[model samples]
Structures are given as C-alpha cells and as structure tokens.
Target chain A: MSNEVQERKARIKDMVVSALEVEPEEVTETAMFVDDLGMDSLGAIDLLAALETGFGVEIDQAELPRLVNIDAVYEVVAEVAGWPLTASA
Target chain B: MNTTTLVRNPVITAWSAVSPFGIGRDAFADGLHAGRATKLALDKELWTGPDAEACLVPGFTAAGVLGKKGTRSMDRATGLAVATVGKMLDDQPRGREIATGDHAALVLGTTTGSAQSMMDFTRDSLTGEKPFFVDPSRFPNTVMNCAAGQCAIWHQLRGPNATVAGGRVAGLHALNYARRLLTSGRADTALCGAVEEYSAARSWLDRVGSGDDARVLGEGCAMVQLECGAEDPGRRALAEVRAVEFGVFTDDCGPALTACVRRALDRAGASAADVWAVSPSGTAGPGEEAALREVLGDLDAYRSPDLSLIGDTAGAASAMQITAVLAMAERDRGAAGRVALITAVDEGVVGCAVLGLA
Candidate 1:
C-alpha cells in the first residue's frame, strides 16, 4: 500500500479511537463498531460528527449507519473529503 | 396520627463531593475545614468573557476523570454527576452493594443541565449548512434531565430516576424528592445530589440573572446515598435526614424561612439549640442569614455557610452546605449524633433540611 493509504487509515483510526473510545488495536480494518467496539446509538452520532470535524467534510446522514468499521469509515471519509477513493482502497 | 413523626428518615449511609478544591469527599472536607477561597483565574482558552475567574473543580474534564469511553458526548454537568455518584458508591461498600440491585434510584438537581451544551447545540443548528445538520448526540445534553438520566445510566440505578431544577434550591428539592421516593417504597436505596458546571454561558447567565449579588460562579457535584429500612450499625454515615421542609415566600423570605426552619425542627423532634451546625445558602440576601440567626442564635454550633470555601455553587450550593456540616462532623467525635441544619432561599422559595448526624 502507498503512504497515502497508510496515512488515511491512521487518521481514520485516530478519529475512531477518540470518538468511539476504542483502542487503536481494536479498530482493526474489519472490526465492527457496535459489535466489537461497544458503541451504541450515541457513539454512532459522535463518530459521525468527529468524521465531519476531523476530515473537514460533510457526510450524508444516511452514510452514518454504513460506517460499520474502520474500513467502512476510511472509505466514507475519503470519499467525502474528495480523496482518490480507488487509490485509498 | 402524625405521619411526620412516624416517617422513618433515611440515614445518609455514604456521601461524596466533587468540589472546586478537587474530587472526592476528603478534598472537600479539607477545603471546608480550611475555609479558604476556591476561586481561580479562568482558563483563557476556555473563557475570555466578562468574568476572569470561577470556582471550578481543579483540573476537571469529562474525559479526564471519567476516562475517554462514553465521554465524548457527555457534558460537564452530566460528567460531574456521574463522577460524584461513582465516588459516593466507591466511598462505601454498602452504597455499592445496596445500589447495584433493582432497588437503586437517582435524583439529581441542576440549575439547567448545562447552559453551554444547550447554547452550543442551538448554535450548531443555526450555523450548520442545513438546519438539521447538527450533531444529534448533543441533544441529550441540552435537556435539564440529562445529568440525572446520565447518573442513573452510569451507576445502574434502575429505580425512580428524577431530576429537579429550582435554581439554588434545586439540591433541597432533590433531597426531599429522594426522601419521598424512599418513604413511598419506590426505591430501596436512593442516591441524590446536585451539580453545576462553570462555563462562559453559565457565567454570563449568572451575571445577568444575579446582577450585583453574583459571586464567582462555582461548579461541582455532591451526592448522598439514602437507604430505606433499618440502619446498619456496622456502617458509617454522614447524617440521618431528619426533616426537609420547603415553603414559598410571597413577600418576606425572612419570615418564610423562619417558619420553615421551625417546622423542620419540630418534625425532626429537635430544638434550635440542638443544631450543632448550620450551612446556609450564600446566594440569598441578608434575610436568610438573619432568619438563621434568629432560629439558632447564640448557639455554639458551626454557623458559617460554605460560600467562601466553595463560592456560589448554584444548584450544588445546598448540597455543599450539607457537606460542610458533614465534613466537620467527620472530624469531631462530639459532633456524632448531633443535629445539623441546612437552609436555602431562592427567589420565591425558602427551604431547610435537618440532619441528625451519625
């Protein structure tokens, strides 16, 4: 993976760890937020706000529920922030 | 049949305070004993408004004391209440043991949940690209009952959750509510208290609302565990809540308070001379002080209100007043089994509580 991919993942991980109150190691690419990270409805809202704040992007309200894990969040943030989605993946 | 005489007053089996001096009961006790001021220069980053100082819980942050988990959306008032409940439970094994069951209840008092949270949420909605683009997570904090609900949620208090908002008398309202809950058999163990948060919004409101009388806005939480049924001889307690009486002052606060204090003393089966300590709400005018002196005049009791030590704690003021008396009781062996009084007069309301020290 390119440095861009690593950086985006790292930044997204930081947001997840802070917003969801999960450990960095716990926010693995496939780890589900509600199932694995102990996040509930409020946590989901907080994470969505954090994404909008951290990336300086606007995410569709519908996209909040789809942000199920680190990989999902990385994709959504990259897309909303206008990063090259294909290269990020 | 006089119900007041037959009613079993719940003993405060355990109590805790997260005060301007610091967190926990011991810190508050030390500060109260010292009777020193707790006002500090406001953090410039946090506030650069008209007020330059406040009595804030030293080095307090929602995430700092409660950890990062579930704190991102927790406002200061809720955070303080949660922390105080945690400390109260941790202070006594009985509180933890009794309050963990389905019988536990919570009653929290606040001026308003957190003025800052409400203002911030409103600002977000008004400034967002779309009116609905605001963070929904903050909506909970905007409500006056949020801190009480959060305390119940955090502490697993499953019974009779309540929140009372009556300005400085909010704490008294909460204590009375808890007593009723226990008397009504709605809860076995009721954790009750009040909290206030120092913020730019609250400070601004305090200044405008209180005008000349507003002292340095102070913030903290103080909680007491009220248990029903028989008192356990093995456990230590701050006081047995003898009586809590509240009345409205249509015109004269002094006369209203004097009557309320007399009623409370009568119900508690105690006289004015029996009161070993008195913690008056510092926000009220000279009327409150004069009434207190008239009732417990020339007594050798500890008569100082806790305002100088903790500043105007707002909703937490009454609780802190009770805490001042309790803190002194903890140090003096002679204070055990003595009666202590706490009184508050806010706007149209005058209230008092008599505690039989344990």
Candidate 2:
C-alpha cells in the first residue's frame, strides 16, 4: 500500500476510536466492529456517518454489511475514494 | 369495626441517595443539617434563554461509578437510578447474593424518561440528511420504563421489574408497590426508588407549565431496600413502613392531604402525636401546610421541607424526603420508636406514608 493509503487508514482508525469511544490501542485491524469493538447497529451507523464526514466520501448503503472490521472499513473507503490498492490484495 | 389491625410492617433494610448534596446517604444527611442551599446555575447550553437553577448531582459520571461498559448510551435519569441502586446494594451485607437471586425485584419511579434524549432523537429523525438515519442506541432511553429496565439488566436482577409514573408522588407509589409485592409473597426482597434528571427540555417545560413558584427544579435518585418483616435482629433496620395511603382531589388539596394522613395513621394504629418528624412534599404550599398543621395540631415534630434547600426533585422528591426522615431517625437516639410521616401532594393526588424508626 502507498504512504497516502497508510495515512488514510490511520485517520480512519482515529475516526472509529472517536465514534466508538474506545481507546486507540484497543481498535486493531482485525477487531470485529460488533463483536470485539462493542459497536451496535446504531454505533455502526454512527461510525459510517463519521467516516463519510471525515473522508468526504459517500458509502453505499449496500456496503454497510461489508464493514465488519477495521480492514474491511478501510477497503470500502479505498474503493469509494478510488485509492490505489496493492497488487498483493 | 375499626379497620386498624396489628400487622407486621415492612422494614427498610438499606437506603441510598444521589442528590446535589452529593452521592451517598451520609452526604445527603450532611447537606440537610448544614442547611445550605444546594441549587446550582443551569448550564448555558442546557438553558439558552433564562438563568435558571437546579439541584443537580455534582460530578456524577455513571462511567466512573458503574465502569465504562454498557454505559456509553445511558441518559442521566437512567444513570442516576443505576448509580443509586448500586449504592443501596453496596450497603447490604449480602448484596451480591441478593442481586444474583431470582426473587429480588426492582421498582423504580420516574416522571418520564430522559426528555433530552426524546427531543434529540425526534429532532434528528426530522432534520438528518436521511429521514431514516436516527441514532438507534437512544431509542431505549426514550421509553418511560428505561431506568427501571436498565437497573434490572445491569444488576442481573431476574425478578419482576416495574416502573411507576406518578409525577411528584412517584416515590410513594414505588414504595407502596414494592410493599404490596413483598406482602403478597411475590418477591423475597425489593429495591424501590424514584429518579429525576435535569434536562433542557424539562427545565423549559417547568417554566411554561403550572409548577409552584416557590419550588425550583432538582434532579436525583433515592432508593431503599424493603423486605417483609418487623425489624430483624440480625439486619440493620432503618425504619418500618407502617402504612401507605393515597387519594385524589378535585380542587382543595388541604382536605385530601388531611384525609390521607389520617388514613395512614389509623392503619398504623398510631396517633398524630407519635410522629417525630414530618417531611411534606416540597411542592406543598400554604394549603398543604395548613392541612398538615390542622391534622397534627401543635404536634412537636421536626418539620424539614428539604425542597427549600435541594429544590423539588419531581418524582424523586418523596423518596428523598423519606430518606431525610430516615437519616434524622438514624442520627437522633431520641427519635427511636418515634413515627415519621412523609406526605406527597402532586397534581390532584395526595399520598402519605407512616414510618416508625426501629
């Protein structure tokens, strides 16, 4: 991944932390939104809105279920914002 | 035949309070004895137009008392109820044992749920970018029984859970309900109380509504543990609930209040002279006071209208007043075996409870 994608990923993590009121260290790339991070359906919507506002990107409603973890969230944002993905993915 | 009969009264095993006096029963007692006003200026963000004051529980963070988990979405009313219940349970010798049992019940009283959350959720649904994008977590706080329901869930109480809404008499209603449950052998032990939280919507409503001019708004929760018994030797009994009576009036509260007190005293088999203290509802003005004076007639009792200091806590007012009476009984050895009368006048209803200190 490019440095810009890494920076964006970091920013997205921060947004999740703020939205969920969780510690930065507690939120990991593999942490499940609902199971591990304690984000209920409402919290998930709150996170989606926060991410959209912070990144200035519009996420499709159909993509909501795809946002299961931090990595999945990053992928959706990357796809929507047209960020370049690594060939290894 | 006279209806008065000899019967075992429910004992108040433990009690706790969260008021502007601060968190616990001791703080509440100290604040009352200190005789200083507990009212503080309402937050500018909450009250944008006029400078209003309320008795808000200071530095109360539910996360601090109850931990961070399962509290992020809790409103102030629910938080106060939970925190007060937690404190009451802590005072019990086998609090954990009682809470984990299936026979322990919870009955909480509130004028309503968090008005702020209700308004905010409704406003969000109307003005949000998408019509259906309202926050889902706040939906639970909008319910009238949210506080009682949350208390049961958080404490793992699996028994009967009920929420009573009786405006200013909510505390008496909760206590009366719990007493009935205990008497009927439906529950082994019960936690009963009332809670009120200060909010922008509530403050605005009070200003516009037909509330008493003398009483200011306040917020807090007061809870007591009740069990079917005549004072147990092993347990610390604060007071014995002899009887509870309530009645509705069309115009004059004076006669209604007098009748309620007379009924309570009669059921308790006690006379007006037996009462050591009287904690009438803070909202009770000249008419109610005159009724109390007429019924009791020059009775030497400590008349502590806590509303003058802590303000009117709405649904929680009666519970807080009873708590004050209990504190006085606990502190004063002279008050032992002396009855205490707590009266609540709200809307068109008058409720009275006679408690005898053990």
Could you say which candidate leads in DockQ? 1
Cα deviation of B338, candidate 2, in Å: 1.8
Number of backbone clashes in candidate 1: 0
State the C-alpha lDDT per candidate. Answer: 0.83, 0.82
Instruction: Specify the highest-TM-score model's number.
Output: 1
Model 2 RMSD in angstroms: 3.3
TM-score for all predictions? 0.90, 0.89
Model 1 chain B: worst 10 consecutive residues (lDDT sum): B298-307
What residue runs in model 1 are displaced by over 4 Å at the alpha carbon? Answer: A1-11, A28-30, A34-36, A52-65, A74-84, A87-89, B1-6, B299-302
**How far in Å is the alpha carbon of B99 misplaced in model 2?**
4.2
Off by over 4 Å in 2: A1-15, A18-21, A34-65, A77-89, B1-7, B45-49, B211-215, B230-232, B303-305
Q: Write the per-residue lDDT of candidate 2 for residues B1-358, one digit (tens) a residue.
A: 5333433567888889999899987888888887868888777775662336777788777787777767877888999999888877886777767644698899988887788878888997798666556556667899999999999888877788999999889999999999988877788788998999987788777776854454477889999888877334777778889999999998889999988999999988899778788888857678888888888976445655455687778889898888888877777887888889999998899999999888
